[model samples]
Target: MNEPIISVSGLRGVVGGSLAPDVAMRYVAAFSAVAPAGAIVVARDSRPSGRMLASAVHATLCALGRPALDAGVAPTPTVGVLVRRLGAAGGIQISASHNPPEYNGLKLFGPQGRLLTAAEGEQVLAQYRHSGPAWVPYDRLGGWQEIEDPLGPHLDAVLSVVDAGLIRSRHFHVVLDANHGAGGALGRRLLEALGCRVTLLGEAADGQFEHPPEPTAENLAGVGAAVASAAADVGFCLDPDADRLAVIDEAGRYVGEEYTLALCVAHVLADRRGPVVTNCSSSRMTADLAQRFGVPLVRSAVGEANVVSAMVQCGAVFGGEGNGGPIDPRVGLVRDSFVGMAHILAAMARRGLPVSRLVEELPRYEIVKTKMTLQRHRVPAALDALEAHFSGARADRLDGLRLDWPDRWLLVRPSNTEPIVRAVAEAKTRHQAQELCDQAAQVIAALG
Candidate 1:
């Protein structure tokens, strides 16, 4: 059996092979052990293994004398909001996110309804490694309850962030590809609330996807066609867990995930005008939007928790990653597809422009990503060589070695779980970005 990919957020692995009930129980026990004794919200995506893992989490929470509030299958962000809405101590989302169907995992949340930070995750790991969970006595055993209205509060929160009245007046024709994941439940409701004439693909919340689960540009060809053929105002494609959203313009262009954060930031800054936060790997389009608004843009280390921490520190009105995850503090700390959809539409309506035009108004950059197989021990040497090779460019050693030019930048970082080094570059042209990535790859390879 392969080992699960355990990280600060949670653990993911192929079901039965690496992630079985025992492993899930142990991880859940570790989470419950560290969490304060209160109602813990448990939710899952539409994966086939979700029920088994969710049951394991529930039973473990109960056995540990901590109440478990079952939210059934829902998006990852919905679980976070539900945790806060219900005032639970923490939450667990049984989802592998964009991974293949065979993979499943647990996503743990802190009391304030956010993913655990690096320090908190380190504590969880230490507890899991050194000592077993501290179980409760029979007299102090916790209880269990089920909540069916998970989508209602989430929908309300999303609507609050946007002008629902204006959106409903527009009655935008929209198509949503939920990919048969847990997003369908709240997604459909939120669209209807905004008076969107919605054509839902994969409406059922069954784990079976109509295509590859990730909402990448290549995978979203069919969605683009659907939007154009239907003459919908826009199209929204969500990953299996629905936290990440990729947009399709009204003209049938695959705007991709990177633009999701940029467009949302552009809209919010136009009206609210405050500090914006995103991870280091995010596009400069966000920074450009901040500059246009005369606001400060703060960059955090990659990961939702890190971004949220920075947003809190900077009092950012909006924050997210470049991976199509938009975190609206008005809604919740978690990245929300519904928030992305609402804000994009509201931005379009307020601007009196089409999605394509809105995209064109922002800074344009091509992001190219590549990876090379390398041993973990060689990463330091590779970073040193790359730094020397790109000596003229300004370098940042925050999460990795990032070299920045006037309009281009390259990031070289090692994969936390895989034996590979990830390289990402952005420039005005695809060729330029590719060249940057290739150069980094060669430098890393030479380190051997």
Candidate 2:
């Protein structure tokens, strides 16, 4: 069997190929070995393979004499909420997020309802490598229990943070493209509670995708037309686990995942100003939003766990990635698509502006991303050459090689799972951003 992409957070790969039942069992055993001794909450998305993988996970937990609280067909954030709400030792969400249907994986959360920190993840990885599952006698085997209302706590948590009444008063019409992910049920309920007339697409929790599954501009080709025809005020698109969201404007324009965080930060900082945190790879428009609110903006290494760590360290009021996954401590520590939806609705209601106008008012930026294949031995020289070429720009090695200018920036990062280097550049205009990437590409090509 091929190896899955294993990390401290969890592992993901092709369902029956790289990721198999035994792999999930050993991974869960590793988590259970390190996790505090208490009942664990296990939730999953609507993926078809989730059921089979979840059975293996449950069996492993039971063999370890660890109780399992099965939260069937729930989103990733919901697992976090459930873990904390149930006071469990930890949580495991069987999801591949936005990956295609043939893929599946597990995301582990600590007892505090957050992704495991780097230190914690390291211990789990070590445990998985050296020690195997500690199976117990039948008499000592733990049992599983199905959760009755898996979505309730998460819904209440998301609704409580935003001005629900204000959003309801607006009577906004919304088009939610759940894309047959685990979040469809909760997405529909939350939208209706906010008094929005919802036009739900692929709301089933069956892992059957109507689109390419990733909620990107290119993938969500026809969704905007549906929003326009429904005469909806806005459109919301969610990935498989519903942890990430992408937006569509009132004009049926794809506002994209990057603006999801910026718009939320814009609305949140206005209500309660505090430090903001985002990954290094996120758009700089959020930094401008933080400045507009006179709050500090801190950028951490690229990853959701790293962003959460920075948020906790800084006590950030709002933080998220450019991938439409917003983390609001007011809701829960996990990247929450529901919270993003609510806050965006609140922003629209409070500003009394169309989504398009709100997006227009924000600072403009274009980020272009491209990658090149190179041997691992050549990565350093390529990075050095790019850094030397862009000598005038400020450099930061926080996550990768990032070159910063007054109004433009460039990032060249090697992929964690591939023998490739990705170059991302952002500027005032698409032409400028593309030019930056082009320049970096030329420098990297020189190393060849």
Superposed by TM-score, candidate 2 places the C-alpha of residue 225 at a distance from the truth, in angstroms, of: 0.6
lDDT of each: 0.90, 0.92
- Index of the highest-lDDT prediction: 2
What local lDDT does model 1 show for residue 139? 90
Off by over 4 Å in 1: none
TM-score of each: 0.98, 0.98
In model 2, where do residues sit more than 4 Å from their true spots?
none
**What tens-digit string does per-residue lDDT give for candidate 1 at 323-377?**
9999999889999888999999999888888899999998999999999998888
Model 2, position 370, has a per-residue lDDT of 92
lDDT of 1: 0.90
Q: In candidate 2, what are the lDDT values of residues 233-339, reduced to their tens digit?
A: 99999999999999999878999999999999999998898999999888999999998889999999988999999999999999999999999997789999999
